[model samples]
Target: MSRRRPTVSTSPSWTVGDLTVHRVDEIPLPPATGAWLLPAATPDVVTGHDWLHPHFADAQGVLRLDSHSFAFVLDGLRVVVDTGIGNGKERANPAWHDLDTDYLGRLTSAGFPPDSVDLVILTHLHADHVGWNTRHENGRWVPTFPRARYVTSRTEREFWAGYAMDEARAQMFRDSVLPVEEAGLLDLVDTPADGATILPGLRLLPTPGHTPGHVAVELTSRGETAVITGDCVHHPVQFAAPAVGACVDIDPVRSEASRRALLGTLADTDTLVLGTHFAPPTAGRVVRHEGAYRLAPVPPVAPVAPAPVAP
Candidate 1:
């Protein structure tokens, strides 16, 4: 299947009390990405859940995933949840190799420019999630958010540090992860069983399995709450079948356990769930459905248009 062009406006935002969470636009992954990423989500399995059609998946059951980042401001600190694939990066996957997109422009348009960012919360050190950590400049990869502190779990950083990496992963670290580290911008936090409160209302929930030290971000304010799922729950179809695991999951059994646990808490709640890779109408409320779970779609509030000025 061919790639679908972005149909939505530049920056779509959702409200969680006083905070306005923005979804900056990036390139949408090809339809084939679903099959390769989540082989467990076969056509038959996807079609079984009629609710997924026309939004999360095509009528033919091809899963729709995107590459974008979530941005918001908390307590005077400008935050970027994850950085999608960056421009001019080499990778083994053809879909993510040496491509270009106006990701930074979208971020700037959303009111969270690179230089103004104070914190970058990375759920893991995956290539796509960390791609925009650096940008090609003057024949060198430099930290995009020079002023921000890039954060990830200590376990995550330590795991990769001790492991033998392939050419592709090593290359990703060299360009995207290393530049930030060398600039003294990367910070590794210890995520405990009960999770860690990074700020007044922001917390890091340990939902490892996709990676040993992977985490899901939780934001609470004025009694309202939301969770930003990294890769733990890639598509809403996983809500129906939490057992279905991704192909790249470092630990499949543990991954499903984490998904099931996370979904159990989220089921039948008012808490908003923001998917890291979900397509348009990305955020939603989770509710019990046929003994499982499903996302009751919550479309983002349209960005207010600027007032017209007299010529």
Candidate 2:
């Protein structure tokens, strides 16, 4: 199932071999988010990659990043990758604080109501990525997907356990992450240097640097493959300059090495790269461009509604 065309949906999905990965819409991050998150990506750096325009950047070169999740049912498991910044969370970042978007409604429209999710994969413990892990209910935070097992890397969990976190991060854990763990629903896996296979065809590839325990998800079905970039590669600009990294990266050097390594394997391959923060037309393939790399955009298939049944 390598290199299949995308299938459209009201929720915007891409068909990888046999699986239809839905991009559940969350609120678009403020334009300022680009400058704050990836400071190294200057206007000059961005405008140089003309391919990024109209989709990934403006004519002014301000990057267009999004906050969304990928939902799909695979081998009887209904999965969600990286819950976006949830509603009603208290945060220091103005863009993410006290969001009131109808994220749950959008998820339900995509056929994945919170309760129906079987697994919640946390790429890392960043506030934006894990904000939807729980919901404010009855004056307390509770696991939104009470029935699902929330998973993240053990190393990632342990790193934060010992690190000194500011009030904001600690508050994020109190509201979004801790409740799931307290519910005995959090599962931490040991991701080695190579990676770890969590299911038959789903693998977690170690993509540290953005975070100590961060990982990018790899999905395969019918010989077709797609890799979800979980913060390791935020924007398409990185495809053109893998060295440019996120500002919050715990280890900038390792982040660069990891980015280089991941891009190296993906370049000129048939695998579809799904960017966690990429704006619309979010999925694409890595290609060699002017001695570096670029994402050849893959737009979602235009959605067609089901035909009416005879009365």
Candidate 3:
């Protein structure tokens, strides 16, 4: 008699051939003010991008900026991108301070355990992106993915060496990044100029601006492609006005240029896009509309379950 294996499911997923991408969102935060999250997110400004309603915003026009983590499983390897602001992290922002989201549990329920994750990618070293790299253990931060090799850009660490001040950054380095390094699990690589293919189908797409070494993770399987947009462009509002950057971007000017260039490059292509901080229905494609770019979300893909691994 054959034994049945235990199973895990992460719906809201998209697959191409052998690769599967699942959205494990962390929080559904209230809409941040335009002056802070994005000065251009003002009522009048967001009003211009009328497409934002129903999905990206509420009836009152408040833009939603949720933090999410995507699980990429292929060929028996589990790779998680952009760990969201993790549980019990002490952040500078009131909203992020001491979070308790069921992020890790959600990841576990989705089929990939922290120990089972083979690779963890940090597109940049922001507090939100790197927070879950470690978790609180024995009154000290410890690597969450105990058996995974954490990957990040060498340039990003160099920048943090000089800029690791302020309450937020200092805290992140102390809690999230340092612990991972202490465990000897952090692997630094060059910021790929055009997505140096790290894995068989995964590449690092250099799209800096929000941070000095910000890069998107590009996945290609059987000739189809999808790029995770890190923090290069925060809100879809940037789709219509790429120049309107967030208050948190270290170099807003350079970030805008990077966003515009990326949008232009991906406009009307077959490549799917997954925004690091986009609201639900996060996967989309960039298209030119009325001389401006907009995201046309890939019609939602139903969740599918595969055979479970022997525990």
Model number with the top lDDT? 1
Q: Higher lDDT: candidate 1 or 2?
A: 1
Residues 1-311 of candidate 2 have per-residue lDDT tens digits of: 68533332488888888788889888888999898889989999999989999899999999999999998888877899999989999999998889999889878777777778889999999998999999989999999999899999999999999999999999999999889989999999999988899887788999999999999999999999999999999999999988888889999999999898999999999999999999999999999899889999888865533111112
Clash counts for the predictions, in order: 0, 0, 1
Q: Of models 2 and 3, which has the larger lDDT?
A: 2
Clashing pairs in 2: none
| Model 1 regions more than 4 Å off | 1-10, 305-311
lDDT of 3 by residue, 156-275 (tens): 888888873877678778899999988899998886576666788888978777888888888889988888889998888789888889888888888998899889989999988888
lDDT string for model 1 (1-311, tens) is 99543334358888898788999877999999999999989999999999998899998899999998998888878899989889999999999999889899888777777888889999999988999999999999999999899999999999999989999999999999999999999999999999988899899999999999999999988999999999999999999989889999999999999999999998888999999999988999999999899999899897743211112
lDDT value, candidate 1, whole model: 0.90
Q: What TM-score would candidate 2 get against the native?
A: 0.94
RMSD (CA, Å), candidate 2 to true, equals 5.3
Give lDDT: candidate 3, residue 169: 75
In candidate 3 the C-alpha lDDT for residue 157 amounts to 83
